[model samples]
Target chain A: MAPQSPSSARAALFDVDGTLVDSNYLHVRAWQRAFREIGHDVDAWRVHRAIGLDSSLLLESLLGDDADSLGDRAKDLHMTYYLGARDSMRPLAGARELVRELHGRGVQVVLATSASEEELDVLREVLSVDSCIAHTTSAADVDRAKPDPGVIRAAMDRSSTSGETAVMVGDAVWDAEAASRAGVTFVGLLSGGISRAELEAAGAEAVFEDAQDLLDRLDSSPLARLLSL
Target chain B: MAPQSPSSARAALFDVDGTLVDSNYLHVRAWQRAFREIGHDVDAWRVHRAIGLDSSLLLESLLGDDADSLGDRAKDLHMTYYLGARDSMRPLAGARELVRELHGRGVQVVLATSASEEELDVLREVLSVDSCIAHTTSAADVDRAKPDPGVIRAAMDRSSTSGETAVMVGDAVWDAEAASRAGVTFVGLLSGGISRAELEAAGAEAVFEDAQDLLDRLDSSPLARLLSL
Candidate 1:
């Protein structure tokens, strides 16, 4: 593998769950079941929109005042349910190819996700492009997750890249907000069940249908513009 | 219950799955599992977008050329998976109240959905507003489902309402299209994870966050205009 050029290198930071793996709905289901187990009957669509946030933030956003008392048990139940269904998780189309292509182009590719290290390992396995991942940042590395900029900043710092030369690809509004806060360009994908309009409202500069669509349009995409820069 | 005055009576038609009940993601999961069971790996987001269409149309839309061979088995598997998860389905906030309010105002309330009879029974149970629902059209009542206008028209017919006096509330683009085709006004909800822009582009005159938001703003919504008319 060729070393990234220090002076003019660009980086591609990605959110793993919905952005690369077809697991957002599974996460939604897990959270729904977890909430139900803890005597809270949260809606699935509500949980779907909360998938990319840090687990604690997710529980708070969904449970509100109840989160103070029920968050820990809900989080534990979520992990159990999520892991039980992990075998069905698959990579989004062109996920591995997109990562490989970015790495092959000498761009620093980092997995920037709010998933725990254990969960990240499973996601990486599903994505099956770890060799192309130059660096990664998990929930453990940050005190706050998206829409906090901490995770994005951590990924950029680990990749030794600046925001001007980095672009974040993600499937949630939280990812767009995090990228915006971190001064990185945001590219959104609709594969996470988030709408393009919502993504744009959250500051996405460009939007694609999914990983395959992004890969197909890479030459004309924001990533391509970054590569040219 | 008082009979609706034909001279000024209006109707409110509703799409069941994502519009009233929080089951779109569950339907996405069911479709995903069903496809996998039949040796096809359809993405959940893809299934999510196809939720409001008829089963055959959904299979065709997702599987294309292979749908001819695998559609029936996939449909059966989908029913089994969906039924298994039906217990978790819950009505969106204010779903029943919205129906009851409309019905109490002397407006005809119709449950217009592409769901099968059995599935509709489960959804109706979840919403628990059957008394307010004067009529309903399941898949058995229509040869073709939404995006084809058959189901919406069936609901209108059953309610003894004309397009000019009725409004269709839904959470998917297909519902917008079907309402447009049926010549009924379309109101959109964001509860299904579809974007407002997409719904508006599909011909929704107004959009709300969910059933709760719509109910909260009923006096200022398109439904209010129909009430006055």
Candidate 2:
């Protein structure tokens, strides 16, 4: 590849929920509550595996034909429970610092997730790193979600960076797979419940324990190396 | 572009329903019956635009959040009504001839549609050109649907052709937009009730009155010119 000019922008694309925010189990609980409220008992493992998917896709993935009547209600219930649970929301270790660190080093930061605008507002308030975030690609902005590359591609487009210039950091297989399929570099964090092996199997370039671990190892990470490219 | 050798394989990706089989109006009626049965009344015009989308997405598009109870049942109801209505389904003019013409010239033909396998089974029995078809990509084979490029990409992959070497022929704006997004050539047909202006606006390379008109003009069409490249 030809050397990129300094003017060519670079992006650090982050998946909001599990990677930076401590919300994987929270989502699981919320989904459980929603399902129970809608008169269904979905397995927590299935919902965990579906963490990074859009709500509709998640419901379809888990319940398949059984989610018909409960689709909208389940989502509404999850959102309600989740919103009520938001007071307990917190960023994973160094989540805000990592975004700030990337921004400090002139890397554009973009959050690529399937959360709706209202949901993102809550997440943004919790993360408190809005100034560092250059752009956000949400589910409402795209027809589909993670593992399909639509959200990641949208983030790349909004960040004005090509896939090769973006490093996607997340804590789920969907994020890793989406980045891999989109030809973007994928950095994985174990801040979420997903295993390192799973993330790597999904095509993560590097895996860290959490945002703080990634931040501490930034000098040796793909984002730092790519910037120096 | 470099010239494609005569031996280099090419593919014709046909979107069933309105593009070849004259079932767009049939689908609208089925959807209307299903939605009405589920207590919502959606217009036929709304159903026309949602033709190329996946069934779950179609319900969401028409009824919005009101499609919760109808998502799975609406599909079941549509399939039930549609199966009964299949006696009227027939391939559009020259549909079989066009598939045969492409196959005669050594170009593989693949069907790219969001219809379920059961629905495709019904559509295939109606079209009765199975021997000429190289492969078929259905909604069940993909994680997402038209306008997302999953089905088109899957068709190209199944047919062993790159997007540039594949031509997507359909009769809806969603089909045109999907082909455009996938970087495949798009040929639009007007039999599906979508206007020529709409298809062209969505980036169709050529528009025909129907499949027969495309077959009659095949020698002068982009599909022919590309195959000869």
Q: Please give the DockQ score of every candidate, comma-separated.
A: 0.74, 0.01
Candidate 1 residue-wise lDDT at A84: 88
RMSD of each: 1.6, 18.8
Clashing residue pairs in candidate 1 are none
Candidate 1: global Cα-lDDT? 0.88
| lDDT per residue (tens digit) for residues A19-104 in model 1 | 99999989988888989888888877788888888777888889999999999999898999998897899999888889998888
Best by DockQ: 1
Q: Which digits, one per residue and each the tens of the lDDT, describe model 1 over residues B148-222?
A: 999888988887778888899999999999999999999999888787899999999999989989999999998
> What value does the TM-score of chain B take for model 2?
0.94
Off by over 4 Å in 2: A1-6, B1-229
